[model samples]
Target: MSPLPRFGRIADGPPAPAGGGESFATLLAAGGARVERIASLAQADPPGAWYDQPGDEFVLLLQGAARLGFAGGEERALAPGDWVVIPAGCRHRVAWTDPARETLWLAVHLPPIAGRGAIADQ
Candidate 1:
C-alpha cells in the first residue's frame, strides 16, 4: 500500500490576523519535519527576546516585508520571494514587519541530521 496524495493552495488558506496579530497553521508533518503557514500583521518579538529552537527553520516570505535580527547583532531584510535558513540553537528574533499590510510566511522545520554541521537545502 502507498500513502495518498494531498493538495491545497497557500493563498486559499486562513486569512491573516487583523488589528496587529499573528497566526501559525501547520500544513504537513512527517518524518520529523514540519511545514507551516504563518501570517502576521504588525507583529514582532518583544525587546530583549529571542527564539532558540531545537531544529533548523527555513522561512520564505510570501507576502509583505520583514526584518530578522540575530543575537550577534546582524540583521536581514526580507521582501516577497525572499527566504532564509536559521540553524538550530541560533538565537534570533523577528525585528520588524510591515505595519500596513498582512505578511505571509512559509516555514519548514527540519530536525538535525546526525553528523551534519549545517542544514542543507532540500
Candidate 2:
C-alpha cells in the first residue's frame, strides 16, 4: 500500500457558480478525495439545482450558518460545526446564508461507489 500524503493549510478561492452569485475554494485534490473551503452570500436565496456527482460529499460547517434546500423541497439549517452527509446524485443547493457573518464550510468528496453500493462500505 502507498503511504498517505500529508498536506498543510490550503487556501481556496471563490467557486464559479452558473447562477448570479456563488463562489467556492478548492483546498485539496488528490485521487478520489477533494477538500474545499467555501464562502458565499449570507442573504441569498437560490433555488435548488439538479446536479449529480459520482462521489458522495461530506460537509462540515466551520463558521456561520446556512440552510440547504434539497431537490425534494426539504430544507435543513446548518450551523457552525454542523456536518452532513450528502449522498451521490442527490440534487441540492444552498437556500440561505447568515447575513451576520461569512459562512465557512469544509467539504470533502470521496471516490464514487461501485456496484450500486455505498462508498464507505467498500
Candidate 3:
C-alpha cells in the first residue's frame, strides 16, 4: 500500500451563507476518504443550514464547541477533540456553536455503503 500523504496547509472551500457564520476547507480526498475543515456558530439556533450526502461522514472537532441537529429531532453537543459519525443520507444541521470562538471541525466523507439503499431511506 502507498504511504499516506501529509497535509501542510488547508485550502479554502465554498463560501457559507451570509450571517450563517460558518466556513469550511477541504483537506483531503482519496478513493473512499475525504477530509474537510469547518467553522460555525456556538449556540443552539434554528434556521441554520443542513447537509446531506450519498456517502457517510465523520467529523472531529478541532476547536470550539457546537451541537448537531438531526432529522429525527436528535441533537448532539460536541467539543474540541470530539468525534461523530453520520450515516449516509442522514439529514443534519448545525444547532449551535461557540459565539466567542469559531468552531473548527475536521470532516471526513467516506465512500457510500455497498448494497445499501439510497441515503433517503435511513
Most TM-score-accurate candidate:
1
**Model 1 RMSD vs true structure:** 2.2
lDDT string for model 2 (19-41, tens) is: 43446667779897898887755
- lDDT per residue, candidate 3, 1-122, as tens digits? 99996656432444444455777666777797788877675444466557778788878887788888988788898887899878887889888887776677788888887887344433
Better of 2 and 3 by TM-score: 2
Clashing residue pairs in candidate 2, if any?
14-24, 15-23, 15-24, 42-97
Model 3 poorest 10 in a row by lDDT: 9-18
- What lDDT does each candidate get? 0.88, 0.73, 0.74
User: Mind sharing the TM-score for model 1?
Assistant: 0.88
The TM-scores, one per candidate, come to 0.88, 0.73, 0.72
**Top of the candidates by lDDT:** 1
**Candidate 1 regions off by >4 Å?**
114-122
- For candidate 3, the lDDT comes to 0.74
Model 3 spans > 4 angstroms off = 1-6, 9-20, 42-49, 117-122
Poorest 10 consecutive residues of model 1 by lDDT? Answer: 112-121
> Which candidate, 1 or 3, has the higher TM-score?
1
